[model samples]
Target: MTQTPVSKAPVFGAPPRPASDVSAAVGLAGLAGLMVWVAICRAWPEIGAALNLPGPRERLAGSSAAVLALVFSGTPMVLWSLLVDKVHLRPSTGIDWSAPRPLRAVTDGAMTKLAGLWATWGLIAFVYCLARWYWRGPYVFAMDLLEQAAPLLFLGAIPYVLWLDRVLVEPRDGAWHFGAMLIGREAYDREQVWHHLRAWSVKGFFCAFMISILPGGFGAVVEADWSRLGADPVAWSNAAISAMFMIDVQIAMVGYLLTMKPLDAQIRTANPFLAGWVAALICYPPFVLMGGGGVLDYHQNTAEWTYWLAGHPALLWLWGGIMVVLTGIYAWATVAFGLRFSNLTWRGVVTNGPYAWTRHPAYLSKNLFWWLATLPFLVTTHSLVDAVRNTVILGIVSGVYFWRAKTEERHLLAADPKYRAYHAWMGENGPVTRRLAALENALVGRRRGAGEGVVREGGAGEESGQGDRHPAQ
Candidate 1:
């Protein structure tokens, strides 16, 4: 798992969030400004008309737009400030300081390659759109494709730019170099970067898949005339919930794809637990794609969504609010990971954002929501014992997630000392661990009782009880 080291480097550095970079500044500022604009647009009508927004529907949309603006604009500046000011990373070059000619040529070559690829792709996309316009009535335009493709295109393009820079600077044996190519001053293993590239690509594709499906869902919501909010408020709330979840997914996918800095070395290898793999597989699409029975379907467990609760306005609002907050926290945790986000592996030990307060914010919030939403304790059967059994079965699913958390810790602890240190810190400082310890003791006591009962049921003699009893007894 050792990465190949880059040789012969001395390039000058530039800040990623330079004040002089007008285009970058404007782009980010524009996004933030647009959010403010949207907030004005949505809020103005309500303010001017004094419209009532009591239910979850309109309130959810308004809140989402406001939050998205902060996420899009604020996150980048914060991350940039951290990298530049806190990390204090500087750019360096491999070429000798005197080799100005080689540097110019290398830069020219890399730029030329990038320009050529982009132009070729642009031309092809344009032609495709043109053909579609002529042959099919009201065809999709280049702008439409660009709108959808921009974020993904950036994800792929940035990596290529970094890879090209690497290639130019650290040429293969006998490869030509124009001048010294600039890269991060810190030494990063070539193989690790390659792994990151592969990981990001895979994750990006998955994100793309998620992003692609969301528009259709939104389209369906829009067509349904959400403003009416007529018959079923639960349905409206569900749509809003789905929309918020989709937006969260979009942010995470986009951020994860974009955040790999060329010099940000992969700190550790991915060593996932078998339990994590199994638990994740049972829950996500891979299992369903493989035609495994949807053994862990949420819909099935959510039989707890009773007709009584659904009809009660107060209950609906309460449940809806809880669900929104839980999902929001889950999404926020992913956002906190920023570029280090990955599935089934500890990409990096994030101690910022939601991670600053709690280690498993996503898992904790999500499982709590599952328990509330499923209401397993309320589920019923003609046989009282059967009802309890069913509730226990549903409860076990959430328990599996607890096992996942432990497995994650073990895997991460093996990968880096940071995770081990993080675990120790959590043990000392985390609020949830104490509650868990108390619950564990309670469960242990109950289990001992059950085991003792089983021994009695098996017709063990008094002598057997003497052997099994506590030493004090």
Candidate 2:
């Protein structure tokens, strides 16, 4: 007898791919600006001498100069977004440039917004004053810089608000709602006010951290001894890694600072969940739980890849190359954000570059690099207990990142439908996610089959017992 042919399972079809919130051109523009600034910084000494400029005859690698680099990097991005991308014309910007409101009509709204904006800044400044950490170490540099620029920023806000209001289609944004509540002259959504506060809190907290760390990486990259590094794989890798971090920091700093509606780079919503706040804050500054001596410190008794791989030239080279690649992926993930990168905030949905492969490319690459480079399981102490403890601690640290990824996803899923679509697409089509999904399905299928077998056997036993008891009936 011929058996009926079995039908093949239908192929998995991915959901429609969502458009990346930030355009490729915008990222390229920012990258171009960053490269220009790097070139200028690296050659500044020679350029200064050639021009007979009255400054130090050395590369401008000071914190002040590094701070100034923000201008070089940010200006081009802004110009390109406005002139090339025409981002201001987008409906998402909440602007109607063609029908600008009369100055008198927008003045009252602008003034109220200014009040809210100023109050928010004042509150942030007060918090900065209260936080003792802001006065110490790297944060001192940030404090100094912000202190110097406070007056200018205050003055600049006036014209910026006034000009923006004239073109804004709906001038009553979160900030306006906040101002209305404070003034008590108009009705306002409490949720909108809270959103406004959360957005600024993210900016306030992250901008300082980004600015504080900028000079360290910027100087390392600017002053790296390329000639000496080429001969040593470890040194070369370190330099490359530092340069990548410098790029990430520079781009991220620009992102935090340039949260303008016109560029369509404003924070759409900060993560409202407390769990998200905890997950993100614990990774940063004063609250970081993974730093040395902290509860989650995983570096105890550990030797880096360099030490363990020592004396093996081939292995060292291969390992160093791997580390550099991981770091590059992490940096690329940040760059893909362009001006939208910020912690616990949904500026936009990024579905390009490293993100196209995995939803948490930065965290994945970063955690992998840490594991590979630290080699926590191979401790310097040579004690199994130490090795196990270190390994477990590092695993916990990785778990924290996973927690962060989930929290971020939770925020984005609720905030934007585009992100929901992107999430679905990633689950089906993403290189890493698709394989994970398939494995999960396989495991689940096996479990269901085992459960069914148990049920069938139990039912069969019940039938056999009943048949035996009813044999006479």
- Candidate closest to the true structure, highest TM-score: 2
Model 2, span 139-244: residue lDDT tens: 9999998999899999999999999999988889899998898898999989999999999999899999998998999898888889898779999999999988
Q: What lDDT is obtained when candidate 2 is compared to the true structure? A: 0.77
- After superposition, the stretches of candidate 1 with alpha carbons farther than 4 Å from their true spots are 1-205, 216-240, 262-268, 272-275, 288-293, 298-306, 377-390, 441-473
Q: Give the TM-score of candidate 1.
A: 0.55
Model 1 accuracy (lDDT, Cα): 0.44
Summing lDDT over every window of 10 consecutive residues in candidate 1, give the lowest-scoring window: 464-473
User: Model 1 misses residue 377 by how many Å?
Assistant: 4.4
TM-score of each: 0.55, 0.89
Best by lDDT: 2
Candidate 1, residues 1-473: lDDT per residue as tens digits?
Answer: 64322211111241111011011232233334434544553454455556654543332233234334435544554455345433213222232223233444455445543453354445445554554332332222213434576678746764555454543334321111111112333334455444333343334334434433434433333334466664565675676666556545544444444443332312234333456556555554434321223444433323555354866887777787778787777766655544344555444455444443355777777777777766655544445555565466656666666665655555555554444444444333434433444355466563211221111232321110110001000
Residue 199, candidate 2: how far off, in angstroms? 0.4
lDDT, model 2, position 33:
78
Which segments of model 2 are wrong by more than 4 Å? 1-16, 439-473
Give candidate 2's TM-score: 0.89
